[model samples]
Target: MREVKGFNMTQTINVVDAMCGAGKTSWAIQHINENIGQNRKLAFGDSGEPMKYIYVTPFLNEVERIRQATDIDFFEPEVKGTKIKSFKALITLGKSVATTHELFKKLDLDILDAIEEKGYTLIMDEVASVLEQYDISKSDIKLLIDNGTIEIGENDKVIWLDDDYKGKFSDMKILAESDNLILQNGIAMFWTMNTRAFEAFDEVYVLTYMFDGQTQCKYYEANDIKFKKYSVEKSGDHYELIDYDPTIEPRKETYEKLNIYVDDESNKKKSPLNSNYDSREKLTNQQRSSQLSSTWFRKTATPRDLKQLNNNLRNYFRQVQPTENEYIFWTTISDFAPTLKNPKCKWNKSNDRTSDNFVALNARATNSYGNCTSMAYVYNRFINPMERNFFREYGIEVDQDKLAVSDLIQFLFRGCIRNDEPMNCYIPAERMRSLLKDWSEFKI
Candidate 1:
């Protein structure tokens, strides 16, 4: 592992571009472990102490999984060593913690003070998810102005009242607001996420997965030039040459495509670069109606319906002890169901949710029975005979009865099903197993 340096009081934010399931948390853990191995102590205020690291994820389940992956007993309060914690609990205790972005936004002054006083490194996982959640509305700007945190001059130039104001300012208050906080307080942040996280920062590290399934990390500094350009504009039939700062406008660029074999093949088939899918098109009547129906179902799903669905699943599982392949299928269902159920899930940006929740659910169920090749193995072995025997014992006719397992799972989980293709149900079985294991203790 290469040593990640230059992150200190001066340089605060560093973004890492890595694919999902690319061992980002593992890399963070290894870095911390290396520090411990080297016996390096960090200073906090007047006291010379060991510096701590905080890993922040986007979800609670991610926190648990990351904690487990560390193979460290983190729950013991007395242990001054590293531990995983939610972003909400970072200020209170736990020297080294793992938390979500949702919890981090609610940080109080006391917590911020503690963080500043006691030196710590923040490793933000799934940064794109966090960034998507950060939206500065007009109301927020008004409140900030009222509170004197920010002030607009008579000339309309924005001024930050905070003591830690950096030279970088923007007409767009949201960018300025984010920059002001991150650049101040000597808080070093390490961000890791997929390509969707496109915010320009101090430094960026790109992690690429090779054709052989190995990951390589490369560091690059953004040297994109910013210069002012004058343009002519007509206002009320009067032509005027207007001087505009294009820096305030968002930079438009295509993401660098990685040359992973699978990605290359997929791109060849349906490249977004070659496609002309206009996302800004007005919604059709059918789409509008479908969206309304979905919204209605999501809002009006009763507790009784949810309870019934859960009962059905429990009963089904009780009747059939799944084979290894079937268990893998069940694992995917368990992992996906919760995410679909979660209203807070960033499904749109992440593109994790499929258009047809029902078809996706059925695809998973059918895949559990295994593909043709695996089905041949099941029949050749004693598993198929045993399953048939069990069905007979339960007085269930295999051909006579149709199981709407997918429909039940989808409706129970997401509260609605759409008439569309299940294109996004291709999760690897190993990843599904890990997710299922993490969600073992999770209720609902």
Candidate 2:
């Protein structure tokens, strides 16, 4: 491996920012197959070694897809006990493997040594969740500091002084050991991706849409990791990689198929629901936050408002645009999802799923909901305030509103529209609706 600091920035990074449903995965499959064939031809060369590959995606089904497509043996890390041991075994054996993003993120500092041993190309099916709002109460943070179990440095970087510690905060000890935990303003804790994880790869490819609007993109910028942009393009029968053209938007017709709900006297609700949320750029942060947000559904909305919103949800599924019993995809905060769930509209096609059609409001990188034609974006999208604050603390600027729209498009694309079919969406939040409209029309 080259000196970690000596790798050429451009040579190491390639981002395939194709529009959703543009076959980014297809292109990746083709790239891997070709690389394998080329490697085999050079088996007689001086090194006589085939380069290894590590493919990580958001779902297990996708891992299976790549593993099944090629003739090469792709190992799905089996837990003899823990995932870290299984994954390190695959890398240490120098095998081309496929795995889920969750397991990929669970990898520890020791795995880096195994990765650095060879030239492995890394293909990330979707940008991993590199930053998250760590759920630790303020009381816990204060207690840890007071007990001499932790120390805080500049940028509120949390250092775990208690390595041998195990118990209530064993999870904290594990994260600190990985060297990615951070405390924002000594209040909010976040688990950041250890950027050094990608250092040993010959090259890295991240496939997704609106890459600029993703938190991973900002995280990469903050880490000074430079990447080049590419997109999946269909030349004729097959998909291939090409320089990403912002002007070239494939399948715009599918976006035209969305029918956003607009409430009036004719609708079940006497007034427009969450209509005060429009002109989001002009609203104060607090004002913008309270409208159609998860917090609003949980705390801000009055009983009367909740009843009306619940009725509106039912109206959309039962009356406004009654389903043909196609899997109905809807989303809101998990706690309030039950109250707002339309009666008898929850489609249970599979017994395995806990919430058959209740996809998380911020979900992405899955095709499980592609069959869903009737989708309800019950909650408005908002950039987590901590997300914005984290970037700000690093003096890195991010466009929150742009990221909001980017998220909406990725989530909405999970519906039948992803299959290029018409979808009737119930997005009563005017601000989210407008954002979708503006983005669809290429005004973004």
Candidate 3:
């Protein structure tokens, strides 16, 4: 945190760290309008030209939202030629533009050349995928190093020593040349967004919820970039910036409204546990961890266990709590969506996805499912152990539990509950249920 929330121009990296329904996007639009009016005369690197902005969001639909709400003329990456070419032309013209995060990641030295003098501000609608593991086998990496094709530098930085290397690793060579590829433990490869992109901008505003629990936050700290924190609050008909508070939880009414289908003796009777398995067998916390996880859904689960899960899903939507005409949503890993999907009821599935009502477990930063009345988040979320080890190699200890809770929170907000509407949620995994409960009570 750099400064208290206000209309300040000094901070280069600003995080509007607000909750899901706190109207963060509205505040950003207002801030843009104010900057357009004032032209940020006292802002850093200002040369009396009008302030230029590049609003980047996670989805193309959000790009349209910014274009529709803002008063300024917004240029998108055109389809005439390469999108990068159109974006480069926009940078040369010093115009405020809107695009997706994918294009923002592709910003190279070429774009930096055009943008260095433009003094453009960046408004990111959500945290972009700042760090991701690059899938390559350890032996393949060994071949690259053993053959004098590449060299591992300090801190496992993969350096392309072979200038004439235009073979199978050409794509890796390009990324390595641009300083985006990172090696972990001399085996795993990772792709991180270049921090130089932020240096090219006059200032940056990242509008998102739970920024601390995200990987991008850790990425910034590792690079020694300092950022200020603010929160969006509605005063009357308008929104304003307030000091960030991490403890902001949903209202008590909201807690009462959301029903995380509890598993009890009575509920188990509705979807009976098959007698094939011994009822007296007690599961340890370790054994129970597999329940509703990818391991259980894909491999270890017995037919009776899956039947009970499917039956439980049907019991909630059809037997226990029924709704009319409204959309329903549920999430699991993409691979297990079909395995757990309820094909009996139409409303149990949301439209235009997987030809059924299946949402992804990692879904976030969108308002496309506001009308969905019910959602079943079936997977027991966990961070990849290899990815966690990658961060640890850089002296950054990842919070696996917080990240899991954060993922569930982001996915839950995608439903009608975000607008303070009552909704039904079912989590078959006991760990996920406890995590959700802890979050609702501000326990974690």
Question: Which residue segments of model 1 deviate by more than 4 Å?
Answer: 1-9, 12-16, 37-48, 71-94, 128-444
Candidate 3 lDDT tens digits, 1-444? 111122233345889987788888888899887767456344355466888799999788889989999888888989788898899998888788899988888887668757766777889988888878887899999999899988877556678998988787888997788767878777789877777677667688998877777888877777667788997778787888778865654545566888767645655552232221212257666767656666666667777676666676677777666754247778777765555666533323344563555666666677888888887776787767776776666677777667777788788889898989888877666677677677667776
The lDDT leader among the candidates is 2
Residue-wise C-alpha lDDT for candidate 1, range 174-220, written one tens digit per residue: 33343322111111211212111222122222211110111111111
Measured with C-alpha atoms, the lDDT of residue 125 in candidate 1 is 56
Candidate 2 whole-model C-alpha lDDT, 0 to 1 = 0.76
- Cα displacement (Å) at residue 108, model 2: 1.2
Segments of candidate 2 deviating more than 4 angstroms: 1-12, 39-47, 263-290, 344-355
Model 2 scores a TM of: 0.89
TM value for model 3:
0.87
Please give, for residues 1-444, the per-residue lDDT of candidate 2 as tens digits: 012344445554789998787888888888887777454222255355686789998888888989999767889988688777888887888888899888888877678757866667889987888888789999999999999999886556778997678788988888977777888877899998777677667678999888888888888788778888997788876888888786788435756788767757456652444453243236566765557776666566776666777777777778778886456888776677666655634533443355466787667778888988888886676667778888887778887667878888888888988888888888877678777777777777
Q: Which of candidates 1 and 2 reaches a greater lDDT?
A: 2
CA RMSD for every model?
A: 22.3, 4.3, 4.8
Candidate order, lDDT descending: 2, 3, 1
Off by over 4 Å in 3: 1-12, 40-45, 162-168, 246-249, 265-280, 294-299, 302-304, 323-326, 344-354
User: How many residue pairs clash per model?
Assistant: 1, 0, 2
